[model samples]
Target: MKNALLIIDMQQGLFHGPHIPYAASSVLSNIRLLIKKARSSGTPLFFARHTGPDGSPFSEQSPLTQLIPELDVNVEQDSIFIKKYPNCFRDTVLLQQLKLRNIDQLVIAGMKTEICVDTTCRAAFDAGFKVVLVSDAHTTIDNPALTADNIVRHHNQTLAGPFVSLVSTEEWVA
Candidate 1:
């Protein structure tokens, strides 16, 4: 049951937009706590940053491509995988890297719950890695049809099952 913590797209660019994701502050705090625990527990930590072609918010050179300042991502220790599409695994060495580290179970958390978070969770499960979705550690902005709160709630329920295990930061850290 070797495990690794996977953080996706908690980039500075995500905060620049007008609509902050639901519970953004709480999510950040929880993720920071998770990072702290991982560091002390000797758990491996990995980050996936989104980088899109020119004109996208995640441009190659954009400062937003970097993780938020508050996150304690040590380049020498934690590995970072960059993705251009929704699925973080595609065109990325994430799977291979995880395999190299002998990681079979992944504890995943990060921003935009409906997009990268959801996509990566499904993909990781399909790829045969057991996944834990840190329930309150991910978030998204409200859409026209649903509030961000509802979106997070919907995904938390819908994504739980054979594909993913939904748990809070407390449960995950323990």
Candidate 2:
């Protein structure tokens, strides 16, 4: 099965101030590792970024709309997709790119584990792609009721098996 690494919403906005996900450092580390592996293995890498209207956080003039500087993405070397919706495929050409790359399996990692990450995982599955989440490479912010840790754990457990398979950074061979 051909696989592509899909890094979703790892933008400057998400890492700033109160929007930072839990275990941000570790999550970034894992994402870096995954990026390195994908590069070495010649696996295709696709990035999904969230954008908003003129006044929102992801406005064109905002630095937050850009990918984090720490991410190892080269504009000339990788593909970047922008979506206004939480579901990466909703308003983007993500699926088209996947089809062009002949990718049927996806290795996903990114921010807002409960939102974009979760929604994309399920949508990818429903669209008939094999999906595996770099579980530790995705994270969330604390909500009114639950801590970010709890949300991560809950989604990891709930989203496993059916929507996506889970793999830790250590166990991720690809």
Candidate 3:
């Protein structure tokens, strides 16, 4: 199975503000590790950036839509797909790009586990790609309905069997 790494919405806007994702530091670190591993293993990396309406953090004119500075994104080497919805495939060329490269397995990680991360994971599965979700490399902010920790846990459990194979950053990297 050919492998590719799909990083969803690890944008500056999502990391800042009052509602920082749970375990932001560790999640970022894990994602960095994944990136390193993918580079070393010759796995292609695809980054998804979410766009929002004007006045929102992810607006086209907002710097928040930019990828986090901590991530070493090479415009020349990495593939970036701009998305306007929670499901990265909704209006993006991500699937086409992956197909062009003959990628059949996707290792997905990034921000907002309950939203973009979750939606993209399922979409990738429905699109017939074998998906591996980096369990510790994705996160979300706490909501009134559930703590961020619980949200991550819930999505991981729910999506594992049906939508993805669950792996850790260490496992994937090693």
lDDT tens digits by residue: candidate 2, 45-117: 8998888899876786678878887887889989998898888899789999999999989999997888999
- Better candidate by TM-score, 1 or 3: 3
lDDT leader: 3
Q: What is the C-alpha local distance difference test score of candidate 3? A: 0.92
Ranking by lDDT: 3, 1, 2
Query: Runs in model 1 with CA error above 4 Å?
Result: 54-57
* lDDT minimum window of 10 residues, candidate 2: 12-21
Number of the top-ranking candidate, with TM-score as the measure:
3
lDDT of 1 at 114: 91
Q: What is the lDDT of residue 48 in candidate 3?
A: 91
- What lDDT does each candidate get? 0.90, 0.89, 0.92
Task: Write out the backbone clash pairs for model 1.
Answer: none
User: Where does model 2 exceed 4 Å of error?
Assistant: none
